[model samples]
Target: MERSSAHRTPGDPVAGMALPVYIVCGGTGGHLAPGIATAQRLIRAGISVELVVSEKEVDSRLLESYPDLNYRRVKGAPFRLSPKGLFLFVLHNTRSFISGFQYLRKNPPAMILAFGGFISVSYVIAAWLLKVPIVLHEANRVVGRSIRFLSGMADTVFLPDGVSLAGIEARRIRRLGMPLREEVKHVSKETIRREMDIPHHAKVLVVVGGSQGAKALNDWVEETHKSLASDGIWIILVTGPGKNQMPELKVLQSDMGVDVEIRTFAFHRSLHELFSCADVVLSRAGAGTVAELVCCLAPSILVPFPYAADDHQLANAQDLERRGGCIVIDQKNSSNLYREVLDLIFNDWLLGRMRQNLRRLNHGDAAENLTKQLIESYYPGHLRATAVENSTEAKEAVNG
Candidate 1:
């Protein structure tokens, strides 16, 4: 069998110079966060990086704080089965491919690392045409359509634990854990409680509804907050930054009276702190969220978005459930949501057991490990040595 493109011979430029890497992780925060975490690892190791993302409002809001990194944007739409939608998908993809090809031809990187999404399709195609090594990481428990279509062409495929990707050669897939931010690894529960000004003994519940709040989940939480708060459970709700008016949090606090601590924020940049302090989490089953929960050892009640691609979020949640890391609550029968939440909150033994299971499921040092593998797989040792040396000299010159 022919080796994947990643095993192809390296060019003199790639072998002798410090070449930048292009990471395509657009669409949602689930795709973007892992890409950013992996890119951060490469950057700290003296490699230059460029990020290609979709020109969506959510992307802009999530990426606005990372001014130190380079970024480029393209317009993308979800795949639709209708004729008009298909035509638009083709037209947008063709334009994206042409733009990507033009840019890479002018300023090519040594490789492209793609996190699955429609926006990444064009970037992967452009890199393949340029003969740059391509690596694909699919964070979903089930393979996404774009990645499934493009997998045969990738040099390597990386997955988070518990993904049973069939058809692809077992040799081609490696479980690299989830690419997570450095901060996700180091949050302290004590520090988080202090920062949020919570009493030391108070039990904390965190509600995560994705980048835009899940209206159903928020509504449920709103209706049940008074009872939960009265039981001495403090709620930290991340409603996301949407145009919708948030629940009257202050009024809710008044209704619950001083005994309950109910704090609401439209968004929080440091979600690790929130997760770190959580006794239990109520959240959607996005791959990034599950991975973060595992890292933080937070047991959760996962509500999968019923409309997600191929019902993949359901697959993610079920995998966690099977592993004893979480309990799955179907969106359709969410009438029992409060009961489930209360059960987890009140049952210390069950929560502790789930936490133990979650810890066993974590993939340690994911970003650092993946960075080392990418460098070793695609670049020769001398190239890394030269790159580091040149980077050191440049820094020294700037300082001097």
Candidate 2:
């Protein structure tokens, strides 16, 4: 019952192939983090991992620690905006498609595991033509546009839950919660408070609006900093990129004498610490952020971005709201910020209720679950033994 290299077709790929190559992903941290977690699992189980990435936008340093990972550039892009933008985007996308095809034709992977993003789209098309088995992941509350277009082509499309994909035509979808790095599963609140130098008696509120700052939210917080700071609240605001008005906020903080903290960060990996320090998380509802908050059981005041594709952020926030886990505030209604923050923070009963509901949605071991699914779907035969072991582990995890 051993799988032979001669018979290593799409039906059976990962058996008897010495050092079968697993493609680790690198798109955004949202897409790439899950792939990294899975790659670490695969490597421990003795498989070779090759990282497919765009040499641009992603920090190669992020993948530097995993030297075992093979880094290869797949022509990737930022897509188009106007008519001229359309022409340029098409030109770049075509070149990417051609390069991806050539790469696959020369050096093939045992299986292609795609974590959906603009960069990963080229690989999906290449995998289709190469006859490689594919395992795709959709982490958002709604399947992304790229996943929707390629879902029919994948051997299996893995979802965070049914809430994320109700009308997509993909039938091979399985509900496996969003996989996260080892860090998300742990970090005591006291440890986080000590690291951030937060006072034990005050309520700690962490404000983040995706990787790039939410300017609207930041503006509102800046204007109302004194009033909130006077109410025994502490702020840890992550004002992204050039959006940090430190000179301005500092002046306001000094004049008002409010306990306000301003942080301007371009990149940060140790998010578990910040999440743990938080009593309430104020942020735009991105799928990746939502999963991490759920892991920490952080009560969220979700302000979904008004312009995300298919309004996916709104969908993400609404799904959590339905579970009674987080309160959804409209980004369009930043006028209500003061009222929303006050009502949630001062209301002890409301805070505890949210804590209980958010804790109910925590999927503590998503990384292991996702890795097992990819292996089972892509690997076959004597490896069916390993796959069976993986399935049993997944079932036990679900129950526990």
Strongest candidate by lDDT: 1
Worst 10 residues of 1 by lDDT: 247-256
- Highest-scoring model, TM-score: 1
TM-score of each: 0.89, 0.84
Per-residue lDDT of model 1, residues 131-223, tens digit only = 777889988888899888778767789987667666789887888777887667636778878887777677788998877667777777678
Clashing pairs counted in every model: 0, 1
For all candidates in order, the CA lDDT equals: 0.81, 0.71
Error of 2 at 160 (Å): 3.0
Q: How accurate is candidate 1 locally (lDDT)?
A: 0.81
lDDT (tens digit, per residue) of candidate 2 on 1-400: 1122342355443433453554536556677777777777777665667767766543364565556666676656655688887786677668877887787778777777888777677777876776666677888888887887777666677876665454445566778777777656647777777776766656767788675567877787678766767765667677665677744233224334555554434445666667777788888888888888888878889999998888989999999999987899897787887888888877879888987888888755877876665555455443666678899999999999
| Residue 284 miss distance in model 1 (angstroms) | 0.6
